[model samples]
Target: MVNLWTSSEHALSYLAIADAIPHRTEGEGVLLNQVPKTVRRILDLGTGNGRLLSLLKIDRPQAECIGLDFSPTMLAAAQEQFMGDDSVHVQVHDLDQPLPDLGQFDAVVSSFAIHHLAHERKRSLYAEIFACLAPGGVFCNLEHVASPTERLHQQFREAMGIGDRPDDPSNKLLDVETQLQWLRAIGFEDVDCYWKWLELALLIGRKPTV
Candidate 1:
């Protein structure tokens, strides 16, 4: 319930160590690979600093991208990331609310975000995502998921060298299986966790072409 992302200090602290999270790029790579190179329009949810959007643009340079985040600090950073790119638009949006009418997208992506939402909001957001996608479109979320046991959770904290630090109160992680099932129930086809490393996982699903 407590999200510190709006605080500049919290946002900056996260950016300071954003790249140091182990195996993060590997999950990102898998996400990038899953999205088709021919997608013309993409939407990035909770797009902090536009890192994942930047990666997505690498291969799909012609794709028009919209990156959404609520934090001013993150919005500024994301704007800076795509300053001169007319094809990329970064805007403010809170994940707790229903999505605005942004039209359909060929692909919808998120990374290391969304877990901040409460569980109910998370499920609703997944349904919203389904509605926003074009037929045959893809939705990929590279997320921080919950561990099965307290022992495993502690091990994950130790693995990330965050055992000494307090757990992020903003995080509302759900297990990967539950999320995959939610996606499936929302009418997504081929829903699955495409890649994983401890608590880091990539959940992907595609709208049926018909």
Candidate 2:
């Protein structure tokens, strides 16, 4: 069965510590800079509490935004965050399944969410994201990628304040190089790992206009 993040405690814990994750704001800033100001519509996958989408909306106040996540508790929190705000739409959808018919978007973004998917599913989901984006659109994934070695992995765990604990079974970490290659092969232009610190990295790619 899919390890959906349904438990309120787990969801809340993520939110509580989400901001304290080191180098996160820097990565988020890079992602924000990459998005074109002309973008009129945006989609966010695995939008826990709609954080990334909410940030995007702050700058692009007139842009239409849609946030998708699978956790019921997360959905509730996101809904509450966007309450009385019409510019953003929040929905619950498992990333383990195919994306819905939400139409096209000028940009798609995710933060520390896609790594939970299986390797094959991650590639397939990138393809789906490509198909859903308008030409010239961009995809920004602030992901938790795998470290180079067991030692590096341990170091990463230390950085995250996790030690002597097993890696989250829910994590299916992929390396930055492989994911960037997949992005390029899937027709994403200018694909690269924009920023990284330990296991946390900002992977960016743009849909070709041609």
Q: Once all C-alphas are superposed, what RMSD does model 1 give against the true structure?
A: 0.6
Candidate 1 has what TM-score?
A: 0.99
TM-score of each: 0.99, 0.97
lDDT of 1 by residue, 31-129 (tens): 989999999999999999999999999999999999999999999999998999999999899999999999999999999889999999999999999
Expressed as tens digits, the lDDT of each residue in 1-210 for candidate 2 is 346477787788889999899889999999999998779999999999988988888789889999999888899989999999998899979898999999999999999999999999999999999999999999999999999899999998988898878767778899999999999999999999999999999999999998
**Position 84, candidate 1: lDDT:** 97
- Each prediction's number of clashing residue pairs: 0, 0
Candidate 2 clashes between residue pairs 3 or more apart in a chain or in different chains: none
Off by over 4 Å in 1: none
lDDT of 2: 0.91
